[model samples]
Target: MGGSGSGNRWRYGIKGTVDASKRLDIRYLKQHGMLRSGYYSLSWNRGGEPTGNINVRMVSGESMTVIGKWRRDASEEWQPMEKTVYLAHTACAYGGSRSWFVCPYCSRRVAVMIIDAGYVACRHCLKLTYASCNEDMIDRSWSKRDKYKAKMGGDKGLYLKPKGMHQRTWQRLRHQYYEAEMQGWQWAAERFPMIKDWM
Candidate 1:
């Protein structure tokens, strides 16, 4: 999603949600040693198709300069854009320090920054929400069920205990999975009364 309106007054509607998938995460960069004084290329993909990419030049632990071309839409020409975002560090629990991106708009220290409309900013400044925020109870239950199923190394309705897993842990997860599955079915039945009779 891109920013709306023209000129310097970019309006990011509070009701809109930004895709977190296309973002620059300070932790990921630091873990990969991309925070060092060097140039790096960042790219994003959707369903195995390339969506967009950006070039970044890091100035050690100080700041990072991002260079990329972005267009508001397919009809518009690609425009070159460059932005420098500063970095902030905080002491970790055991030792060392953690790096964070200083948000250009709000100056808030954030681990991730969303890239949209050729600009990078924290989600709070953009007034955005993650896609999962909009999911209903039924959807959440289904997601939880699927998550446990996958964790046990299986697909839908075919979950199997992974090798070397503790028996008690597997049984607990199986119980929780069944609970989530039942919750989803109950909610679905409430939404569609006709399906309740069939069940």
Candidate 2:
């Protein structure tokens, strides 16, 4: 799962979704169609909440569309949601058309929307959180360092250098990585003593 021969950068390219409403570009769909398709179980990242799985589907039609189902609960009944492409033909001096999804509620053009309760609107409408929303800056920083190390084939220990990277680039990244780690350790010690063993 590193970006080595058998590895790919799939996960890093995923843009965090704001809500259930995400857009699939018309031209892109016509060619690749659901560029990043997968079967995933999502927890809503909430404590004690029900876990659900979403099934994403795509097919050819008047244009192109992606139909999805979000199970309301663990029981298996799925709520239907769709992101279909729409082509708007326009006659301008330049002569062009636009392709976009309009929020069924707001009529504003949007690329993607998360399927929330009744809103079925954009991330702004649904109030989704980024992956880091639940973490402090220190924790995020430490995580960044860990990822950097992993990329360099270093594990658990610091001071390992990567192959093929220039000295200047490596030094810059190494400095930031350690600085972040120290900040995280200091913060952890003061606030949560039990974390010492874990860290």
Candidate 3:
């Protein structure tokens, strides 16, 4: 299966069976994504000169080598008589694009509104940071700090301070929760950049 992501990012998933004795090769396909970006390169020892290109080889007669590989079109057929390579192994290159999200505290991406008063605190950081003004779909209630503490398995009021709650506490809690959750995500992203990218 293959699909396109936000901002025209492309993705492809290959899954099938290959015959080992038919001399069938699904190789010689070059990836246009990586070649345009100049991030990854591929070559073989059997060739004369190195082309710094990428290809996926399906069958090899005797593990031959090539000096350099040339960029090829990916829309070709896999043949049995041809000794080709596949370039569909290129990795993703997002170019620092943003992913969509929805949360008051999360400044990265906001795609939807959350409606949960009991966990007004951020699911990520357990901090009260967001404020929900609209009550079209769900009830807006400021979850007491005690309740949050109880749910999180900590001492009573140890993690919460209700000193200066706004009159619209529930609305504000949504905001706080979103903010705290986003911060927590940011921290986690710093620790594991690849994991954060996938998330």
In the range 1-199, model 2's lDDT, one tens digit per residue, is: 2111211111244434443333233455335444334432223333565434333443322233435565545787766765554333334476664344555555566555455432355555555555554345456657888876765567632465666777777777777778878876766665567877877
Task: Go through the candidates in order and give the clash count of each.
Answer: 0, 11, 38
lDDT, candidates in the order shown: 0.81, 0.51, 0.30
Predicted candidate 1, C-alpha RMSD = 7.4
Over 21-83, each residue of candidate 3 has an lDDT whose tens digit, in order, gives 111121221223322312333443324653233332322221211122222245654322212
Q: Candidate 3's error at 174, in angstroms?
A: 0.8
Instruction: Score residue 90 of candidate 2 by CA lDDT.
Output: 36
Q: lDDT at 74 for candidate 2?
A: 77
Ranking by lDDT: 1, 2, 3
Candidates 1 and 2, the one with greater TM-score: 1
Instruction: List the candidates' TM-scores in order.
Output: 0.82, 0.53, 0.18
Question: Which candidate has the top score in lDDT?
Answer: 1
